[model samples]
Target: MKPVFFLREALRALKRNAIPSFAAMATVLVTVLVLGVFIPVVQATTGAANEVRGKVIADVYLKTDAQQKDVDRVERVLKSEPMIKSVEFISKDAAYKTERERNPKAYELLGSNPLPDTFRITPGNPDDIAKIKDALAPEAAGGGRTVIDPAIDEVRNREEDTNKILAVTGVVKITMALLAGLLGVASMLLIANTIRLSLYARRREVEVMKLVGATDWFIRWPFVLEGVIVGLVGGVLAIALLAVVKIAVVDPLAADFALIAAPDTIDFPLLIGLLLVAAVAVSSLGSGLSLRKFLRV
Candidate 1:
């Protein structure tokens, strides 16, 4: 059959079964909406977590009495280490300035600057943070008293912070995957059921066409096209709803939630397009599956 013939027949079927068609479209809308909203959120959260993870650094704080020369020597050695990606030296004055800028109120109660000079070491790999921290540990200078390297006081790896971020990201991903899978299965089953009902309403007509020598594909294309149309429409509606929520709810409250990563991580338009395509594909698949038993006629 020609394309126009298929289109007309699909439209006719849609008109004849408007209620079921609407039901299928509504199901698609809800399922796709759940998918569209959560997927981006999970992507953004993981991206932000990775960004912060990449910044994980081991801070080597120096004693107040340590000599500048010794500190410089330690920094040079740290830079040459294969496991360390980079090392930045922050002087005591700079550290104090940073603390003051970050929390001015806390400094007001103190009489003088108590911050120490430090070397910020970025590890070559996040998993190797502990190794890098151990390698940079201050050496025992002498007797049983065990004094550290002349220039070092303490080393803080921020291990707890890093682990927490990773753990949270992992949980978010697993939860999102489970939710997406459940909704996807529900959507497919609902679409299939609706398609079956629509097809059953016209089973007698299908039998007549089959007896009159109509090919299986020739009889199948219209129903399949009808389903595709329903799915595409539903997808479009879901996307519109998502856009509204983003603008009205998310965008407005974004400033209050500073921890959320930038939205640039995922391309909104591309994501929406993919969702629309998925909706159509699933709808087509559901329609084909539902028509299997009727095709035996």
Candidate 2:
């Protein structure tokens, strides 16, 4: 079939079934919107969680005066354990200076530098922080070093709490993604079935065309093109819905949550493009589904 002929026939079919076509598009749009919204929400939550994780300092503080060997040894110990991302050493001067800045009157009260040097040791295994705390704290106290491990106590007590909160949020995101995917598939199936019904209603015309010696391509191209148009329309509508949800529903909630590691908020142009792609997918799925029952063409 000529491309123009297919286009003309597709357009004609659209005009003849405007109501059902629009209904199908609307449902598909809603489904796609759910998926779009779910993605950003999960990203935002994860980002915020990372931000919180950054706030979690080490449990043990090792005071080192630029001793590369000591710092390197501590780093190796932490890394070899498991799940420890990194360990860093903070010089005595830096820690003292930071303390002074934090307490404006510390200099006047102490008369001189009272802060000790420390190693900010992050644990490789979150669970190991406790074992490390038990093993290391007594050593710090026994070593008679002026430095202290304040964070060790905090980590020993609060690691489980932090892990629980993070785990809950992660699960929420996963659940949302799964739900969105299911809905999207449901929407596609519904659209395909709708198209199938429309094809069945016009079955007599298709059979007559086949009997009159019309080529399969000539008889089928128009319907396939019609499905594409519907898919495109649905995709466009889905994007529009996503825009409104992002701006009005998501932005306010995500403002404080979109920290490092979070999925950036949806941009309008990008969403439109995604929607267009989704539209094509919907159209193709619906076309293929409908064709299975109307292959006589």
TM-score, every prediction: 0.67, 0.69
Give the candidate number with the greatest lDDT.
1
Instruction: Supply candidate 2's per-residue lDDT for 204.
Output: 83
lDDT to native, each model: 0.80, 0.64
lDDT score, residue 28, model 1? 85
State the lDDT of candidate 2 residue by residue for 30-75, as single tens digits. Answer: 6667666665565566556555545444544444333556656654
Estimate, for each residue in 1-297, the C-alpha lDDT of model 1 and write its tens digit: 598999899999888888888888998898789888877767776666567667778888888877879888778777878998888899989988889989998997895989888889888876677777666663445522222466777778777887776577667667767876787777677767777777788888888889999998888888889889999999999999989988888867876786455645567788899899999998887887678777797
Clashes of 2: 5
Pairs in clash, predicted candidate 1: none
Off by over 4 Å in 1: 51-55, 60-119, 123-128, 131-156, 200-207, 255-265
User: Model 2 segments beyond 4 Å from truth?
Assistant: 33-38, 53-57, 63-68, 76-86, 100-117, 121-158, 214-216, 237-263
Cα deviation of 283, candidate 1, in Å: 1.2
Estimate candidate 2's alpha-carbon lDDT, on a 0 to 1 scale.
Answer: 0.64
